[model samples]
Target: MPKRTATMLGCAVLLGMLMGESRAQTDDPSGSPGAGRATVWIEPSVSVGATLSSNGNASSSNGRSELMLDVTPALRAVLNTARVKGFVDYSLRAEYFLDGNSGNRLSNRLNASATVEAWDQRAFVDVSGSISDQSVSAFGPQNLTGLADVNRSETSSFRVSPYIRGTLGGLVDYQVRYALQTLNTDTSIRSDSTSQVLSARLGSRPVGQQLGWFFDASAQENDYVIGRDTRSDIARAGVIVSVSPQLNVTLSAGVETNDTITLQRESYNITGLGFDWRPSLQTSLSVSVEKRYFGTGYNASLEHRTGRTIWRYSASRSASDSPTQAGSVRLGTNYEIVDALFAQSIPDPILRAQAVLQFLANFNIPADAQNFQDFLSSSATLNQTQRLSVALNGIRGVITFNVSRGTTSRLDSLTTLGDDFDSNTEIDQQSWGVSYGHRLTPLTSFNAAYIDQKSSGSSGISSKRQSVSLGLSTRLAPRTSGSVQLQFGRFNNTAGSYNDAAISGRITHRF
Candidate 1:
């Protein structure tokens, strides 16, 4: 049996044993007086789900399916009469891909904690330890290949960490932690690696009402075999001050350094500040500004809520000396119109429906300075999108519908030095979809969805796509559930037509 399956079975057996012991104690006519003092409790659960997708485009006409199983079991011991307590939690997970080309992955994690109270429960010493392992397969395009080609790689990693926390008086607390991680890879070749990290933080709350401050920092180092070695280090110092119950401010600065075996080392410094205000019970706002060696930006937003209505809006702008700059603004709102109309209805099927529209404008690209300059000088463009969504609920199921339209303007210039450059471009796109989900029983459900999309570009490029999917899920046992899904999609691209279909299933149990 697989490791995950074995672990689930072991947990089931343990739960059975515990139940039996509890029953025996309850049935004893002359139970031992001390028996009542023994405290034992366990909680376990598991879940498994899977999805499959297939595309029609020849270049992407492949099908893929995934199955995952997860289990978690925890136990806790609390001695209210004593000053000590402890708890332990463990989790196991595994995933499998139906596509013959895909590899399976697995993970296991464990956490243990203990705490001791002192000073009339105002202060305490807490300790915690954890261990985890993760393994996964990799396959995809590589820079070394020149063109996209098949290549496979697998990596397994493990981590161990421990930490301690304590409080001084009633106003201050601190914590420190350290962790070590190791990684191993097996493929046509083999490699090994290790890393270490250390972190610490301290915080305090003055005797006054609603004021606090904190500072944190960390550093890490990595060593590798069969590859260039690298090291990264960072230190941060910051503070938070609450001016009043409704206003606050925060500021921080940090330095970062990076070095590689065969590459030149680099270092930089960063600083930032932010402020928040809740002037009233229903309104909140925040803003921040920052600048780096080559770039600077600022952002701000405000939100308000009353009864069943909520409104929100935000805008931001950024620029860099690399001769690149861009800015955008957005506004939207959501309201529970139906709930207000049917306040007396026991279960309104039309829970809510919302319509939203947004516009985006882009100018200049720092990374592609040449292309951005040519396009901007030849064509000034504007883009906008509008969306609408509706949701309905019933005793057994829920349904949702969504639609969106998008458009972009013309481009006028092709060359950096072209005099005729009057930037202008025109493009349009539309998409719509509907989805439904039903709960057949306490442990079973069904879901389905359909979507259609079309797009046209100013360069005479046009395409359309359609997709449909359905799935069913049910519980096989108290702790185990199984699911199956089917999906199909077709696309008519500017180059050609494509279609694909796929079906997949999975089973999972929890402890």
Candidate 2:
């Protein structure tokens, strides 16, 4: 189907279904902050400052005296209704040369997310995207290390997913989902690509059942606009057995086939074992192990919550072609999860009652929003990823800590063409960070953080970096706020070392 037609058809179906259902408003905003009195809102801010570097531009062989002006203007908007939610965060930064004009430039960035519920809650649509200027990778661990170049790059990416799920005549449960994601870079357009996945599943009603049966099928296509294209098909049937109230085990078998860009088409049998355990309200563990054509792999996550603390951990190993986009396809015959865990949205019992039922109904939460924050640790690579994090909340202060580690042996075929990629791409990376936010008063706050990062590239050059930041923010008026921050970053390389320090501030007004 043509892209335009498919989108229109999906929108039409969603609208038609919503037209037939009664309108209702959900009470909670799901922790999303927004304006309460208006459907449309915008907040804008401006900042100007200076950055001093002992060795500017990260050049080690020779030192140069350079100081740059940082001028930034930013805006945020939120739109909320009974059945829809949307937001946009945007900023523009223009650097001026205090000593010279040769290296001054302007940068812009925007991030947005939106969701529309239709069909009386039976169908829904989700859209999200980001265009940002960053001197580091999107992945958390990789971001900790300083980039070889301090100049920020402009990267843009987006995803559109629509889904409909419910039961027919209250007997047969069914779900249909489709998604498309694409990413592009100003530095490497050849890495850009569009990925699409479509899927459907059917199962018997899951209410009050110890054992349930299900069947799932899906198809995925990855078209690298500048590199290669690939497609996949999957189909599977499985049974989930609830051995006890707190524990459940699932056993299943399926088939998967992949037609890759440079590799031969391959088909393989897939077998898997999955377990879900909820020892109590504060704890949950989920583990899945599967046998793949190349090897055996597993993905596991554990979460625990105490009065003032929440902890999360996840580990996964997957062997597949490098992925262009980061998201999940419907589960069918394939047992390998790829980067699905990072892209999915896990379900939360506190958010919706029926959400938990959806899990038992189909025995799979394909797009769970509650998945561990894997995106912070895992990149769009073929590798093993592991992450652990903890957040603590107190009466006057909050603290968050996380660690991420990952390793990969090869770069994606799309990245092989550029000499820069060959020179800077990493084979191993490990990073950790800790942040603290304290409320000095009801309307004012103080924040501080420290980050340490290290990485080694395939080219054999190793580097370590460390950074620390402190800031204070307070309300200036009824609809206004202001902040000032100071930061220091140091980079140590095999050949030499460099350091940077900066002071910046901003004031924002909301309306």
Candidate 3:
């Protein structure tokens, strides 16, 4: 059979199932005493679209067209009072592209949970399971090229977990959870492999007047059927103390350990302290400092809001023993300009802007003291960069518009990475769009939008793109609705020019 015929058959099946479910629910009573209980309801939808593209260059032009179909089905359920009350959900999705250049794909997912209540709703037990599958075809266009190549690949995963939580004597709360995850990978050039991961977490909180404390610890073990093994463990604790009605302080610290089956193991220790203060109803500030064996950093921010205007400022810095240091600062503000004009009938038009600057130093480090000293003495200068962005938005009734622009400048000494990675380069980009919607009747509406974008990079590369879309939605019956959409786009670049068009539609029924 033809691809189009198969797609139509799939759509018919999906629609039939949805209609059957809706009809079944009509005679079912709502969950109540002495009610004939129905345990589940499933909803599904399918859509088909066609895409056509054409390209023209100074020498030649090429064109192609493709028809694509997508099917998505969802499951949802509610259970009655059986010492547990929860829902199970599952989805199956598949897509087919008519053009032989692209291949078909299918994906499946499942999630379910169960819960039990104890001690008058103060304690509970929860169990959950999740599974996923993904597969790709071999006949599609190749993505990567190497000496040893794979024709096709598939991956599947599953996870199971159980946990318990409750408050103790109305003063303290505690919780614990454990999870096991397994993965299977299949490839054409290599033998199939499997892996497993086991993880556990335990935590508790102690309540007090004006002061609270909490602690948590976790561990994970990873084992591969045909690879090296790894393990990780972490422990953390923190405290929150209220100094006044408007002031609070927080302190936290943690340690992490990593072990490898055949390599040197490493450990890291980290600590941090922070606080927040509110001097008035419209002003607030926060600051924090942190240190670790690998690096050190600090951050702070201040914000104020009054009437229809708001302002903010922030800064941060970090240093590493590996001979690298970096810092950044930013200032931003937003104002409601139109709200002050029409307080009753119209909403506000808001404008926002921000400016940021940063500096970085790069140097090499080694275990040998002599090598590290020599590396620093070579004289490396710090690089500086700056960026700025501004945007404005407005809304009135069924129409909305937004516009934004951004620019970046960097120093020339930072051009060692690539032509596109030069520090002395300047990049400018801008985008603007508008959307409108109108309701012709209580159950019907029309919507449209037009968007345009342009961007340029340091390598003198520039491009422009624009798109226009229109859609209509309507209710065909009391329990059924449908929508149709049309879109067109054009793109122009230094290398070539391209144009594309597409049309799609969907219909759904609900109980």
Best candidate (score: lDDT)? 2
* Candidate 3 residue spans exceeding 4 A from truth: 1-62, 70-72, 76-101, 104-158, 167-172, 181-208, 222-230, 243-248, 259-263, 274-438, 448-468, 489-498
* Model 2 global lDDT (CA atoms, 0 to 1): 0.59
Q: Tens digits of per-residue lDDT for model 3 on 268-321?
A: 786889898999966889887777432455667776654433344554543211
Task: Report the lDDT of model 2 for residue 65.
Answer: 48
Please give the CA lDDT of all the candidate structures: 0.45, 0.59, 0.43
List model 1 lDDT by residue over 1-511, tens digit each.
1322333343334333434444443323557565443333334545454544342112344423323232333332222224444433445656554544334555454443444453465454343333332111111111110111122233333343446677878677787766555444444233355556677888885456455677777676655443444555666666777788788887877775655312555776868788899999668898876553223445677666554344444544332111011111001111122232223332321121111100000000001001000111111223344555554555666555556665544221222322111211455667777666677776677877777777666556666767777878776775566677676776576566656665656664544
Candidate 2 residues 84-145, lDDT tens each? 66555567888876766236777766555666776697897876666654433322121121
User: Among these predicted structures, which one has the highest TM-score?
Assistant: 2
Off by over 4 Å in 1: 1-158, 167-172, 182-193, 206-215, 224-228, 260-267, 275-395, 398-435, 440-444, 449-467, 474-483, 489-498, 505-511
- Which of 1 and 2 is ahead in TM-score? 2
